[model samples]
Target: MIVDSLDIQKEIPLWALGDGEKVIQREFVFENFKQAFEFMTLSAEYAEEIDHHPDWSNSWNKVSVSLSTHSVGALTKLDIQLAKAMDAFASQVNSKN
Candidate 1:
């Protein structure tokens, strides 16, 4: 089911685009390319484990991430869960810097 934007906003303040269009977006910047790659690696594994994937891209030390439930055409619990997990992974990466 699609989540309410209000709830999403409270949970995901780092979202670059307001969580009103069935998508959650954020850009995570790391200290370096290696750190960025490490984040992606961890994210990829978690995504696979959960059977949900993100639309993302990486450039140098940055990773742009977008999450949406494509089959439902909206943000669902999975999207929120994945976003939180990704945020945690990003936080861990940054803390190591």
Candidate 2:
């Protein structure tokens, strides 16, 4: 099931509540293009492993991600889980730099 917008906003402040065509969205900025691309690559692997993917774009040092469950026609737990994973990955990458 898709989580309530209020709950998602409260859970992930870094992500906008109603972005991504009324789904959840966030932009991650890294130290450089290499770091940003690496984050995307890593996130992609994880997304593939979980069978959940994010609609995302990368430019220079920023990655814009929009997460929604197309199967459900709304944001579901899978979206939240992937968002959290992306957040964690970003944190880890930041620490490495």
Each candidate: what lDDT?
A: 0.91, 0.88
Residue ranges of candidate 1 with Cα displaced over 4 Å: 18-20
Over 1-97, each residue of candidate 1 has an lDDT whose tens digit, in order, gives 7788888889888885445577889999999999999999999999999999999999999999999998988889899899999999999999996
lDDT computed for candidate 1: 0.91
How accurate locally is residue 47 in candidate 1, as Cα lDDT from 0 to 100? Answer: 100
The residue-by-residue lDDT of candidate 2 on 10-52, one tens digit each, is: 7787988665445888999999998998899889999999999
In Å, residue 83's CA in model 2 sits off its true spot by 0.3
Best by TM-score: 1
What TM-score does structure 1 among the candidates reach? 0.94
lDDT of 2: 0.88
